[model samples]
Target: MAALSRLLLAALLAFAAPAFGLAQQPAAPEAEAPQVLRFRFKPPADGRLAYRIVQRDRVVFAGTEKARAWSHVVEVRVGGARPPDMLEATITLSDVRLDEGPADDPYYLVAKTLEGRALPAVLHDSGAPVETAWAALKREVAAGLARHTDPETARGLAAALDRLDPEGVTVLYRPLYLASVGHLLGFNTDGSVRSYDDYTGPGAVMVDGRWAASAAGRREGEPVVLELGWRIGMDPDAAARALGPVLQGLAEAAARPEDRAAVKARLAAELADGMEMSERADAEYDYALALIARFTHRHVLATAGYGKEAVLEMERIAP
Candidate 1:
């Protein structure tokens, strides 16, 4: 009787095993490699977003040096119906907390215009910025140039801007450009640097008169990280020769002839020694790769045994 009861219990256990998932089952297949950083972005717009900015720099001369750093926030708004593939936004940078800042910095003084100012920032995946959007930013910059200087000086400044490389401007100086377009930059998850043009073949870099650059990618925690940088290329002699007329013009507008000569002489002395330039733009992004968590674009140029480094960073504030 006991053996029969035991047999009955064994049969009952065997019958319930499949229902409870206790039976042997085939192993699940392993997950395939992720298609990392293939840009399938859905631009987030029609709302408000805040981004924090941080920048730092130091100039080293022989044994003496100068360094500075600052951080602030900018609020962006893009209303109306959101586009499925693009974002058009206006950024307002005014009345925000600056967690870090430096005193007696001329560049900072000019950049202060950033606060309380509204600027156009657009994000699209055209591989290059649309002409209209580029013109919009250039217009804002042109307006600022006029507001800050005499007509002659403004014209000189505009000339200087005209001489500037669009690629360099889009990369480092224009915060809005980086904020809106950095994500659209091409990246490779295998840590190989390639040209922005996908058809350019592997190991090739995007080249222009001012820069030869590309970005590499890797996984970092929950975000995709990209390491991008520039190889500084400028002939000091060429630069000095080009800068003399602009400086003289500006000085003519605002200072005495002697002052103008003195300024030109000073700048010539400064750029006399050719510089070696290097830069880095490292960025990290979340799941959708929508926004960079932290993006730092830094440059260090060495001349006459001295080095000057400038750094700029942008971070998105958590909602």
Candidate 2:
């Protein structure tokens, strides 16, 4: 019986050894390399979705729209020895999130396009010239503005230009032409400024110029009002260089206590609109002046709000 027990134990040990050895073996390698980023979004307009892959602020690929509902599946090649490539198709849900991996991942090569494709962004493919497109667009806009200063034309064109994918020439150049025409003659007659904090409030700025106007809205925190506006006139190049200093000076002055008071007093006199007298009104006045001053510094007439980030748009402007 003792000998039989020993034999049985030996047999069990032999079977267990093979099972354990198989478990210790390394697992099969990953099927495909990790992807860079994956996003899902509902189709817009035609539901035909296209992807613009960017890397280092340059667009590498604008994928052809693969329409299958709103779902898209984009595979951005990350790193390694070659330029990141796209996967089979973008056939995922419209609300997909991104999953990024190591730098060595191929996806990083195409990350720029992902970032640059924002609503108000420009896409520049590696084969395209973002700077040149910007420059040409700016030049066309400047030339057009020189010819006509129509606010509708200017604003329309600016908005259109802003929509271009920085990667392609056609997309970049269209806005330039539109903006140029607008700057030459772009001013609307209906100039209205209302304070949201105090409707019919006194703490707002309204300036309708030969080609542009300044509009103010109610202030958020503090009893101040926010101001915004656009205008078109003057030589695009000369204005950018010459008026830039003046605009900067105004920005500085508006932020100053004394200057803020002076501007408010002047605005009241100009509009003859009832002034809502309050110490806080100075802030609203200052805000308007600052925006105006900044506007003066703008060489290119952009219709949207870029604020201090205006420099990014400026850098893209054509010479």
Q: How close is every model to the real structure, measured as TM-score?
A: 0.54, 0.17
lDDT of 2 at 222: 37
Q: List candidate 1 segments past 4 Å from native.
A: 1-42, 80-87, 95-107, 111-114, 117-173, 179-181, 195-208, 220-273
Lowest-scoring 10 consecutive residues by lDDT in candidate 1? 197-206
User: For residues 1-319, could you state the per-residue lDDT of candidate 2 as single tens digits?
Assistant: 1221222212111111222111122223553332221111112233233222211111010111111111112221111212242111121111222333212111221221222222222212111112333444343443443123345434544444443333333332222222122122211222232112212211111112112322333335634333233222332233334333333333333244556565444432322221111111010122321211111112222101101101111111100
lDDT for model 2: 0.24
* lDDT top scorer: 1
Q: Per-residue lDDT tens digits of candidate 1, residues 35-124?
A: 335444333554666667776766443244455676567676654433665556666655433234334232343344345776655545
Q: Give me the displacement of residue 269 in model 2, in angstroms.
A: 23
Q: Residue 299: error of model 2 in Å? A: 21
**Per-candidate local distance difference test:** 0.44, 0.24
Mark the regions of model 2 whose C-alpha exceeds 4 Å error after superposition: 1-132, 150-319
